[model samples]
Target: MAKAFKYGLKGIRGHLEPAERELLRSLFDDVISMLEPEERANEDPLAALVGLDTDAREPSDRALRRLLPNVMKNDDDASLEFRRYTERSLRENKIGALKAAALSLDREHLVLTPDDARHWATALNDVRLVLAERLDIRDDADADNVHLMQDWAQAEDVESYLALVYNFTTWLQESLVQAMVHSLDARR
Candidate 1:
């Protein structure tokens, strides 16, 4: 079982079983794999013809498209240009968030400084976003539909597991956010 975080004067603390930590580590690994920029071959015929590499274009992966959404939705050229300039930095930030969370998992109990708590919040949000994409969950209605399918034996598979993880992460994120808010309030 996973534990909810509680804020302290020093920081925030939570406990997770080693297996739980491993599960989260694997999820983070998946997200990192999907988000990491890849090197393209210089021999692309398309690149030769267009004088640019198509692989250098905006993300073609569905999960990535969600993670780094276009800044300008209506204009393709502008969106692509913006993505080209900003996506690398955005990816690095996400990677940093994931790394912070992973570092917190090195022990049986997590102790996150205020900044680390913030990073964990970002990491949780990113993980949820990727999981949502893989699960094809578009809206709250879709999430509810997954819940409705819980009784069916077939639904007790990966879809069900993903939904459970999604729900769990949501609760965990909420707990962390609330703790942070209360800490801030107390300080104020």
Candidate 2:
């Protein structure tokens, strides 16, 4: 019989003494799966023609109904050790109007703190261009979107911030522990 397993698990073949690295990878995979395609729903004409229909377009869903959520609102990584996602959040935004808008945030004028969500605070226009100069936005549509983000994020004060952080941290811890437990259980 084997002595231990790796995924923080034990005894199972291919699972001996699993380390944090494996845990991280597992967690990363889970997180990535949760990353979501930015455009969740935009009205499919064919689906509309069916009479009664719905479009979930999101990563998390139950068997019967797909859910539509604002991306990263309830990210499962709240349980992890670090705030940084394995993938750079804006990797895809680099060449778009969103990228231009991102370059325009000044931080000083906007009174906008990093909010952990960092540049992802959605939009700065709602804050009255407080951080405008420091931003690099060029698209007028994105500017409109910023106006929208500012309104949405204004309410995300301390309590909500802590809640998000807590959720991510707890999620990571649980996944790690679960993976470990799974490995150990398999050992038997």
Candidate 3:
């Protein structure tokens, strides 16, 4: 029973059919079965995140230098390729999250955190200009309803460098959040 719930948990966290609520119930049961009495204490995530000296961990610059694994951060082209891959990953993650949120809430109207969208609308439009001339994708631009490439344009930052120690959390989140709102509006 415990194993069944644990296995079901993976599906609950994933994009799947609504009928999977039965599995979600199993997952809840598994979580209960897995629960162990606290040895010391546990902090709620929001409190821990906002409180001072919360045992928050910081990664060194050296760690960041090696952040992009499997893509090889050692070489220059590899670095560029890795950045591209990272942007693609973020875009996919945000959009997928959007869909997931809509499904979870069972609402046609969905909203996303600003951090998810990363405002690059103007930048994306500019990229469209370049793609139009360079790749000759202009005339066919409106023809494709899905704006995959534009998302890549806003994905310009090679290193969104972790926000806890970095600054982009604010500037980037505002843009991203706005973008999500815009996207929701478009869908609506």
- On TM-score, the candidate that comes out on top is 1
Identify the superior model by lDDT, candidate 1 or candidate 2: 1
Tell me each candidate's TM-score: 0.84, 0.21, 0.19
Better of 1 and 3 by TM-score: 1
Show where candidate 3 strays beyond 4 Å: 1-70, 107-188
Query: What stretches of model 2 exceed 4 Å from their correct place?
Result: 1-155
Global Cα lDDT for candidate 2: 0.31
Backbone clashes under 3 angstroms, per model: 0, 40, 5
Candidates sorted on TM-score, descending: 1, 2, 3
lDDT of 3 by residue, 71-117 (tens): 44467565454444353343333334433333333422223233322
* Segments of candidate 1 deviating more than 4 angstroms: 41-55, 147-155
What alpha-carbon RMSD in Å does predicted model 2 have with respect to the real structure? 21.3
Error of 1 at 2 (Å): 1.7
Instruction: Give the 10-residue window scoring lowest on summed lDDT in candidate 3.
Output: 1-10
**Model 1: lowest-lDDT 10 consecutive positions:** 47-56
